[model samples]
Target: MPQTDLSPISAAPGAAVLHDVLIIGGGLVGASLAIALDRLGLEVGLVEATAPGALPAVFDERNLSFAEATVNALTALGVMQKLRAPTGAIERIHVSRAGDFGRSVLEAAKYGRSEFGRIVVARDFGEALEARLAELARLRRYRPMRFLGLADGGSDTRAVRVADVDGERVLHTRLLVAADGTRSGVREALGIGVDEHDYAQTLFVTRLRSERAPDGTAYERFGADGPTALLPRGDRSFGLVHGVARAEADAVAALDEAAFLARVQTAFGWRVGRFLGCGPRSAYALTRVLAQALTAPRAVLVGNAAQTIHPIGAQGFNLGLRDALTLAELIENARRETNGAGFDCGDTAVLAQYAARRREDRGRTVAFSDGLARFTANELPLLRPLRSLGLFAADRLPSAQAYLVGAAMGYRGDVPALCRGGTQPGALA
Candidate 1:
């Protein structure tokens, strides 16, 4: 990988420049796709609405728990190696209910692995992505550019209108990718409908320094109100995500540092000891968004654009990363099949294959995240015994533990080659 400058964004309306793929959204997934396709020798274009050298708004102080598969894929793409800060390894996980009689503990060593995944700050991760994107030699990046709308479709390509420094420009591409956020403009333009659900809960995220430093163990505690999570951070501070009812969000946010720390310590026992100090906190309303269709004519959706699930299981980014890698692998495979004779990246058959391959993964991840959230949030007394029984089973039964560990490690159906340990992008058949 090598550095390059931004290409000219203004082109003649009639003489639309054709591309193998035009990805609209230079965030995590889009940038990762550009890097993957760059390896396959394709004319790729990346559209970033944000100003040049500025990180996307999606990157913030929030912390992300990366699954093993996501780690492998990012490492293969050379993005993880450019991380500016150290990451915290998740070697163990503990799950419990505040007043439950039983709990479950998953250890990576039990499954013959050193660690299941790592914890990274969203802001730092975005910096690493920026570093990797700057190193691409052939990526035609259009910064401070806006995706106006979609033009008429062609037999084998799609026309897109975008505006930049000069003016409006028409660009043609064999494939169009919508890696935008939950409220995606491209997906809407493609006539795709989104199914949404409001959880009525607000999650507050921040960093807390406890008496004892994090030792690679992630704790998730469920209560009647919501769930509290303590994730290990690289700087010996714990990343805390405390979920409260939407009605109480304001009061919770307004709490003083000492009061907030006391409430968190009460909800999440004294497992790690007293919380001495904290940092600035942010709040987000939890919502689930799922696209009705993954593909349309000469176009496809990826990342948060395709589906946004609850963050209870920490499955959002990991699932989206898998989507990006799988699509890239399919495109590379199609190109290899044609022996570089130039095949349409947006071929109907190829898009159909991508949808089919992603079916099992998307469904399972959505269900896992949504189900866990709803199950833990139910305050019915009748379900308490059942929840305890389930926890007990997960703790004592090897089969149950295996299933939980597998899902946590992102070993679902039809995994991409790049997600496999030690496998590179071009390893696809």
Candidate 2:
């Protein structure tokens, strides 16, 4: 890693010296944003707290369900090709409650599609993203860079102070993007408030070798205790997510491999067959966090910075990816017009537009995930029957099925040019 020290310049005096965008964080969403912006020929600088190549492929058994639409976005960005490994295509999803008669089965065949999405290991996905990032010549990466604080933004320039492992430095840019995790330093320095609610639960994740093949089917079983999901993997292994109360998380994590496997098998049932072997288990606190606002004067928040939802439906990362793509589209369009002349990248007008573009999608996703969490955790007899009926309707209704397919595919509103597989036109002068 390299170190650079630069004096902080007054926002007004240094208005002309800033890059087009300076993103503070280099996780998946941040890196993706840099790639998208760089493709549009924008000058982008990504500051990361970790050193380059310091990213690890933690063997913690976790995977992501990349919807067809997400796959298309990554494929267009030249990321999918790098992930040249066998993926588990989810042709059908079965949702049911233990001791309940009604269940919902959503099949891709109903929509004339072979699969709703494909599952890829977290490490493989991260590797592919890293490979594409390395090939992007236009994106400047500053690793081992720690964000110090935010300097005030002027009419043209936004000043961000950062430091490396050695000393302090300052970076000037027109737009500031915060893609750090839920506890984002950029968001905090910008005075962005987050509404966080602890779900009083934790998620236990692990990989299991099963006696029977998953057959490309994913299952979500809701019990009085919590929701458990079984997602297929490439090597005939299954990724399991078991939600437990907050008080029980430590106990679950402390369980030996055999004890943990037994609890998992009992919770998930024998639909996929006997759980043969188990890997180490990891636990994460489950909470719902949302930014009071997605964007401030000249700054915007992406990924977990904007919203951190419960992992009930695996919506957190997918939502972040959408945020990255949406902002890129907006910024790319702004760069093309004469009106964009002297436009402050961190201007409230632009930030507001970005926020508006994202509100509906974010709101809907939050509602969906929160509602599912509530429903699965409820034990009311009347609510149980109602939930069963709703599931039956969702399984039987063609229109409902189509809606689910579209939602899962990530095509909610007006599609972005990049998502439509078209080149983003240059921004206005």
Candidate 3:
């Protein structure tokens, strides 16, 4: 992928930069929004706390599961074509609960698709997004910048104060977007609170070398401890996200490679063969963070800022990408209605429309992830039989299987223009 050093700029303190949209936290989602808006004739500015050659810790060694729809959206945005590294396709998913007699399998071929989705390492995806963002003609990139707070910009404009390497300046815009993660500053500054849930579990993740090359299959094994997922990655290895009791996480991390591999093998069984070796591991306490509202006065949240769910089903980023594309479409269509003259980028009516359309999709996604995570963790003996029966029915019944496959492939919920492969108004002319 092509890499560009952020065009150097030194805006003086208190000097104003006018824009139609100002996006805070220029990670993948923020950058994607900037790219979308810039193409739609909006002057955009991205404020990032990290410097150019380095990114926030969330973009560290991690694998991101991209739904088929997200891949289509990336392709439409011309970002997928710029990737230097290839992705691993998830052609099939095998799911089962530990100590259960039944298991379920979802195959992409049954749905007339070659793959359910693809997996890309966090670093690779970020590189592609950053490269694409650099190519934006109407985007002003600001790095090593800290958002001070929202300032009173009077009517007709939203003002954000930010400090960069040079000095502090106020960014004026008609619309403000927060793509920042869980503890979003923009969300907090706007006084938008979140309803939080702790799963009481922690996830230990790393890349693993297997005795045999992965055959385009991903495994989700639920156990007494928690769910363990192995996503196929390149180099004949699998990306492991092993969930364990929060209290036991440190001990697991302290295990020697031999012992660590043995524990995982014992929990997951020897389906895909033994895990030979693994790279360095990291752990995070699992939690679900959801903002009370999706929009504020002249401001709104996207990506994790809007909702953060457990990673059990890999719905986090995929849903966020949908948020980005939906907002873009709403803006594109609204602009056309006004003949490019009287469109208010952050009008209450426009924000309300975006929020109203998002309710069902966001609600269902979070509910599904939370429900699955909790259900798999349930260890009651009586419920085990029922859960097993459900799994078996889902596997054998075509209708049940189709519903499961639809959710897994992200064909459920609202479909966006980018995912449909239709020409977008924001596509470069």
- Please rank every candidate by lDDT, starting with the best: 1, 3, 2
* Model 1 spans > 4 angstroms off: 1-5, 11-15, 427-429
Best by TM-score: 1
Candidate 2 minimal-lDDT segment of 10 residues = 2-11
Model 1, 136-245: lDDT tens digits are: 78788888888989987568788898888777878889999999889999999999999999999999999999999999999999886678999999999999999999
lDDT of 2 at 209: 81
What Cα-based lDDT does every candidate model obtain? 0.88, 0.77, 0.83
Question: Candidate 3, overall lDDT?
Answer: 0.83
| lDDT computed for candidate 1 | 0.88
Please give each candidate's TM-score: 0.96, 0.91, 0.96
Q: RMSD, model 2, all Cα superposed?
A: 3.6
Instruction: Give, for candidate 1, the lowest lDDT window spanning 10 residues.
Output: 3-12
- Pairs that collide, model 1: none
Q: For each candidate, C-alpha RMSD in Å?
A: 1.8, 3.6, 2.1
lDDT of 3 by residue, 1-429 (tens): 222334233524435667777889888788777776767877677888888878667776688888888888888888888778878899999999888889998999878999988988888888888777767676777787899888998888898887866666677889899998889999999999999999989888899988877888989998766789999886578999888999898899899999999989988888888789999998989999999999998888999999999998888988888888888888888887786786778888878988987887799889989998888898888879988998999899999988788777776677677876756455323
